[model samples]
Target: MPMQQRMEMWFQAWNSLMQDMERQGARVWPLIIDPPALLDEIEAREKSLGISFPPTIRKILQEGSRQVQINWSLPSRALDPFSLSGDLGWSLDAFEWPYFGVDEECEDDKRYLSFHVGGNGDMLLIDLSTDAEDPPVYSWGHETGEFLLLGKSFTEFVERVTELGCIGAESWNYEALACEDGLDVEGQVAQEWKEWLQAFRTLTLDEAVQDFEKLVVFAKMHGAEDERIQAAFAQYDWEQVLHVWVKHIEQETTSSNLLPWCQLIVKTVGKKAESWVLSLWESEHCERLGSSLRAYVTAVCLPEEEGLQRVIAEMDEVVARKECLLGYAANSHLHHFRAREVILWMEPHVAYPIEGWDDLFAVSRPQWLDLIRWLDGNEAQRQIALSAWGKMLANGESPAGEADWQEIHRLLDVAYEKAILRKEKERVDRIRSALETTMY
Candidate 1:
């Protein structure tokens, strides 16, 4: 498939996730980008830097589309996969890469091409040596002052990194990377979407409710996961899907279909589904759970702030008893992430261990970090999370829990970089130096 199609599939996946996250009042992603630099512009950048870009990098720069860039909404996938977008193609020397290591023979300007970067300063780089067709990608670890192999070649990097983006897997998945197998992620995600598209294409409006679960099983066998439900819904007509989905849910509402169906209405159908969803919620069939109630959003549909306020109060009442983040709320918050009170509400709670903490720190840790990010947390907040996750990594089971630590490492890097931006340079230096000390 074309790269554009691959991206469209990715946009389909993320758009739904963005909506759900937005419903929680999170700031949408902050990484804005422009179109790829033109070939002449690429050469101009190379001329200014006094070195030739690696062959693969040059090809990408040349091949990349100069079309209008994707807006905040991801309105277009017209560009090439390798977005040298925005202030990209900037050198690593700016971030002090030379301070870590240097060649006696080579000048600082002729060193590396920074192709990809995390929000933190961690970058995936291409060594600009000999203008090879495909150079090995490397990351200069600020904590260790070492250059680590990220990928053996730019092609491999694209395959592996595209998979990471698709599955939201950890970067530098060592096990997969070790044998030089890149999980063929783009193909997998794209194929899964194709299967969903075909399944829905075959689907008839008069489809019997009894066969609904069978259809879901069929889709799963063809590579459907619950997380992709919204992406799947994005492909087909909502009213048509709703027509079939309601019939299926009418038969059995227990599984992933309920949330996806509810999401379809709240997201796509908006106000059209409002009175209907409300009536459905009150009926014996809808089961007035937190998930059911919090779907109201003023932006998409559900402008009835009075109704949403009622939902919030009920959610507060449940949490008042349990004290756990999930506590009695059980996957429901008042959907107040955007509300003015959320930061003040979330701040005091972060310091508390709460009434029912457990080994399943899974949900709480990320939740806390997200809240802190939105709260504009300081160095102290980053320190608390880093210190805690360090212990968690140490106590965690070997090999199996390794991915968790990798994720935490990535998140902490982001948190620390945020501090660096906040003029907590001293704090960030200490944090990196402390991590450096751990290497010894």
Candidate 2:
């Protein structure tokens, strides 16, 4: 027979065997397969991965390679049982190659006599309705012939697919289904919420926020709160307000997600927040938790005459304790780093003083000097130059020109010299001497 015909006959026979086991109510797969054909498939796959097959696996596959089985939500073909109880799913299993993108080329190849034993022992041929259309309903439901059952019995899998099918068949506009799915649901609901939120044909903003909040609570349980979720629900989507609020609370960052809390803090706090000296801090954007804290301070304690000062004081204290220093030599680069929370709070005037001296520690001096020239090498750079000269004078050194501060003149030279552990202290002293000379 041709390859195609042979594969079809194999599947037909495999499907028949599975149906027999289901009718018998044998929850455990007890079928077997012809060993040689299965071995051929395994050997071909082994050749593709260029690895030696374990002797034991070779023996098992050889002994019962021709078995066909139908068990509760597990598949068996000959001796090869793809189950948690089996060696295949274990960490040390020999069959765990091609994490993904393996069978793309040989999808049509009859690699094994796959089986579909549902959770409730509902066995049958492959779920054909799932593939009756061009793009399978379970788009990833079935691949080649490996039954993609997410550990669900037949009854449960069928119910899920049926519901998903109703949504899919209707372009996912199923409000009734969404509301039902939301009932008693727990955990990070991003995936489900994303699907259902879009699927709902009609839902008010208030309703959506409430649903989103539930989703947020679920995510909190799972530790899935991240920047992506915060940004997604940052906007005023009435359909997702509650979820956005949950994210805001979870994130605790004040300046980050400009959501209900962002506006809420500004609104509730009134002029206090409007005039409040904004404070800043950096924390992981776990759903804008920091932003929410900022809002809380502004909302709860603004316009109390000392409220703004108090808030700024508290913020500054937190930052200070964190050892954030506002040094001309070190902090000037903060301007270019957008995520440095402090930079968001600093007014433009705060940067004016050290704007010109940033080049001293720049990654590339050529670029810095080029920019300096573009800025007319004016009073700002002149001040930097004079400062460096003063530092050299203070250190009792002469201004030897740009080459004198060789570290800033060429990026690679300093990096190479700095990596030498023996020269570290000497390099540091030389740099200090150079700075003192330049300043004086």
Candidate 3:
């Protein structure tokens, strides 16, 4: 069958499923098919752009745009329907699509045409240069610059969306209708509570407590056993939840389990949890925590300025104690909110033989790169960064493999070239000497 025909079939199936959902009283966005005049407008756009619309794309334009807004209870999939009307240009318009003689073309730009906009500013693009009759669908992240293949074709994409929508529709209880029809509300509530409990079993104690509280209210309304709910709550040691989270933070296991719990606590408890986390920051184990946990806790516990100050103060204390590695670790955490401060703090110590250069490099890669970019125009800062780079190259053990060694070499080469371009001869000579002595 033709790709357009398959897409039409998927559309019919999706429309029918959505109608059934509406009939069941589920809230769904109304599907709007573009009129013939709108289709003409799309054709006009193609003519103006000097590009031919693929058959599948033309069919989609003829069918019009759709917006699927699933209820909060359902997992979100895509953004609400975006159309070609008023400021909306097909997905390509939102991006810096290269035009012949007008803009430099990206290697991947010529191979795909963006067809849909995602909720998070991602674009759903259709591969145009592929040999397949129905080009594969790809998700392009504007922020991350990642191109992920989503589906083989437009038809498959629609089918997947419809499948998710159907699952969401089925998950709806239609509780009002069930009540009107004299169905067992208590039984339904009991089942949902069991599901919630099962989900909570996979979460940390902090997360479980937060979820359990909401479950209690919901259970009470549904006439579930109050004692059972209370017992379930009692099973979790609420008082120790923060301590457990702190332990995870100290051990750096929070990213695997406790970070989400921390996010939930911050969101649900808000500033109420701030004091508790702040107290934990004073603990001896705070230095052991991963940069992520430290940064997140600092972000949540204190305002930006206060957090930056706290990080700087901690760094100063560590430095005064002659714990240079710990000080560097503390400084690494401030890179996101206070990059300039980090640069300043590291300036005096750049040439110092810091023991944890590897740890600092791993944790502060982006910040280091940002600092380097900033240093590109300033001879003084570039020299300081170069000295730091040389020390790191000399003191840090080369990573295990050739690939890793090559990556380090590549970064060094880039920095060396930047120094040459900026006419920082001393920086270039230092980087060159370091590069010559490096071994995997």
Candidate 4:
């Protein structure tokens, strides 16, 4: 059948599918692809049909065959109805069953457990083992496909799984079986499990402290030589190396371990880390933590002239091209531009004049014109122009007189014809300079 016709058939089968789930005492997660909810459509279809499919029938239609969606609990989960409009007449049952499983640690004699379904209306079961720190052994069968292994019960299974650790094994552990051929199927199945085990088993608080101490010494003794290690030796909260560093620093020892760690904080994280720390600073509920963090940043990072100079140079570039830095214009990433962030950086140390109304006007006119052009459409454009013109005019340094208004309009028209919005600051600067000269 053509894809469009298959989609219609799926739509026609929607009522029967919902009834099937309800019959099995399972909640029906519909696969409707339309908005405004599929319940109303299902009701109308059911009323027209004068019958509903059994739970098995619904399971077959919904998941036993992947005609469309696997689950339809929300609008986001709904299959794209348009997708059904193509050649999509394949069935999920044709390839046996695909049961959706969740991560849970417990089940009776089961290390890993899941669900699947068969045509006989029976839900088959799947289970796996959890012997190694890495991915455990698991198994699956064709009968348990239609089940949705939910979270609450999964937690209960996890508790039981802890109890059953390594005592029982009746069948082949799917993960181990798959690994004998060197595939490490369970490892491939869920790599997060491997990472979690690695973190839990390999990285203890004490071990972390030892490594951190080593890192500190390595950074200070060979700051320039071991720049890579020094660079990598950051006490970043997310780093695997952080927990140890924090502990060692609190101990107040001054041996090689103590000196390097203290020095590492200054060398690696001190001044450079200050800006990053502020970026994450929050003033709401996290104000106390932010204050403490700021204190830490200040205490550890000694002011280095070289570091400060580099930071200042970066800030100056950002401030000079504020339009690009502020995302008011497309900027070449290689060439830095001026920004408010740079101004904030310099404000503490430098005696700088505050920008006035003229500066504001000079910065905004081009932005206003660009916005106007983008919004110049049908009703939407008309509404935006009417609503926004007053705000735009309010930002002008000197209000345009009759001749000035005529010139501004002409230039704007020229901008539209040119279809480019580059060098706007220069354009406005020239115009303002000419106006000043004419006045003098």
Candidate 5:
């Protein structure tokens, strides 16, 4: 397909896709910035970079050089429904530099022309080695400084991106475009994407619940991810969603498959969800489920006097446990039920993170780090313990004592060191930059 035709088709789809995001409560609007790029500037960049722009790229600039956008950095045609799109090459000057273009240790000496710059410092580059009319696209990770093929060609990358926008996918959810094994063009990713669009239509509450369940079973059979199914239940009543998840919890020995649902339940507690929560709390069955309920959801489902006590008690138990790997998230994980007020209420009762906390002193895989990689095993109790400490200081309030202040320093220091070793530059920089705020 010609670049002009391909972009025209995508622009039309962009209008519809923005409507989908609006229905989901996005405060965003699309803009058509016509003649987004200047021909002279494009030619200048090509010459300065010592390479010719791909034919597809040159045609796309003529169609819409830079102007289509929901905001300054994102393109209107291929905007992610949930996050900002990478900036298209428009004289950002960041694109002028190449990854390891100077390092002698770098084995791959292929020159790359970065056409799309990611918000997270990653980039989509056109490989200039053995040039074809339209070259292959590769992604450079900001974290590991590694390159991975994104699409066999720029046209394929364009199609895959627009398809994702149409499906209301988030920015980083690019599994369908994975190019390592091979582009799974007609495979499960493509098939499920079609099915998701079909299943995304407006349905009665009962129909949506039933459809969600069917998708769950189907996804498990194919080893699919859970974000699609979670999005389904999140739109409906907590009572209905929590009830279905509880049923699944009772049926399955491992509550691992239902972590997202449990996380939702934790986020959505109210009078409408009271009776079922109480019933589950009283039930002897699903002792595993009991742990989650007893931990934090109790603070919202029950009376303040009773709920806060249980929350404190649960955290106490976890803190005392040997090598505990995740606890105390109630403070940051709030809902509309005045959860923040309740969290502050427990500030006196609940134990704030400290250097002496069991996991902090552990020889390996402390709770702070373990929670970062929680989905690896057990599948159950995959709650984020890091939030309790990482976000505790960021909640727009001064600490009650010096303990939490010092713990903030500890959490930031520990996380930064780990992030550096893990080669996660984004995380390392974020944590390292905040280390000063933690310093007394």
Candidate 6:
């Protein structure tokens, strides 16, 4: 059979199975397939990317972008029941052949077309360098920078995924049975709000302002006292809303959840809110609230050189006080800012070792390694660094792989030399003892 015909058959079977499951009270969210991309859009994307997508890929794009949630516990040919639940679907632009360039440090063979990113940052990639009509599917681990072959072709990959039931597990409602009322009031309300907000995307500026007022009224009916919402409703004052959110942020007792709403307001108002968010850095609030504000500003507002300096200063204070610094450093926004400056600021503090290094390492190994290397000098820093490293190694916090092991030993060697230069016999002996057990 033709590959496209086979794909259509598989999709039909998959959709039928999902419908059957839903009818059987499986609480499944049906797959969302986006409209097909235009040929001109595809051509433009190909021109820009400088690579022609394979026939199988083009067929999949023609079929439209698909997002579905699968209930793994239910019968399925495509997924492991034990695998973590999450959404799986190609984005609309994935079909439009958006740029999927390899990272600078990645090997030449690592060049692949990324489509869906798993909830855990694992990527579904098509190996472009393989020169196949339909490139083999591979899973790229963000943490390890490793690829695991999944299937020989896109058709086979879809079949395997459907069999494993992996694509859309997160959309399933496990606790849905418990909500016996047959209606999720909160969810419905939130959904309605989201729909209204989405409508603003297509509305004229005047219409958006009118709808914005209606949204505020609706929010008020729900007992929401957010000043930003109120400010928007009254006179469409976005600057006032920004000011109010900044004030709320500076309050020590403010809930962290409010940060997102503040960001939403800033985003709705556009670049005007950017300056307002940045101005909050100098607010006379407690260090915790100030830090939180800085984090929100850096993450949501906009990237600025001044914002990077503020983050570094915040880290310096955080480190000096032996406070939790990982949250700020690990933020996705900080990566967009001065990543190198952030890493440099974080290096000296690795000796103290904040509480969330393991989580941080999973997100950014390169930055983690840089901090690990900073432990190479100074007797006090070496002692703290070695102790932390030894503990993590002993507890199996570090992955037991050859690459990781070699890196660990390299750092250990540096620490050992530092211990010797400091003439700290006890520390050197301790390091030697740890090394004895660690080295193969």
Best by lDDT: 6
Off by over 4 Å in 6: 24-27, 63-87, 95-104, 108-110, 167-440
As a whole number from 0 to 100, the lDDT of residue 240 in candidate 6 is: 61
What is candidate 5's CA lDDT for residue 366? Answer: 30
Q: TM-score of every model?
A: 0.32, 0.26, 0.36, 0.22, 0.55, 0.34
lDDT of 4 by residue, 292-360 (tens): 233334334424333334434543555677522322111111112122232224223221122221232
Candidate 3: deviation at residue 358, Å?
34
The digit string of per-residue lDDT tens for model 2 on 1-440 reads 33334434544544453453344222334433433335667677567646544443344344434333322221221111111111001111223322223546543222221132223222222122323211111111222322332212222322343223211211122222333222112334324643442222222333433555543432322222334434434544533443343345455543323334444333322343333324333333322334335534443434433443443455465466865334342333222221223222332212235433332323212233432232233433433333433343454654322442353444323333444444433443555565554652
Best by TM-score: 5
- TM-score-based ranking: 5, 3, 6, 1, 2, 4
Model 5 clash tally, residue pairs:
3
Better of 1 and 5 by lDDT: 5
**Candidate 4 C-alpha error for residue 344, in Å:** 16
Candidate 5 lDDT over residue span 1-440, tens digit each? 66667777877766665665454333444544356477777777677777667766666765654544432222222112223332233332334546654557454544677655555666667776747777776777766666676667767765665564432112243544465732344567666654544333222234434666654433222222235444554566666666765666567554344444444455433445666656655646436565654444555566765665655555566556843433134322222133333433332333324222212212112333243333121212111233323344354322233334354455445554554334333443544455556653
Worst 10 residues of 2 by lDDT: 81-90
On TM-score, who's better, 1 or 4? 1
Q: Give the true-structure RMSD of model 3.
A: 17.8
Q: By the TM-score metric, which is better: model 4 or model 6?
A: 6
- In candidate 5, stretches whose alpha carbon ends up further than 4 angstroms from where it belongs are 26-36, 67-95, 105-110, 166-172, 180-183, 197-242, 248-293, 303-305, 312-440
| Candidate closer to the true structure by TM-score (higher is better), 2 or 6 | 6
Compared with the true structure, the alpha-carbon lDDT of candidate 6 equals: 0.50
Off by over 4 Å in 4: 1-63, 66-185, 188-191, 194-407, 417-440
| lDDT per residue as tens, model 6, 45-155 | 677667788776766666543333333232221111122233456653553322334545546343787777655556667778878887786665655665566667776
lDDT of 1 by residue, 171-228 (tens): 3322232333323434654445434433432443234223545444333222223334
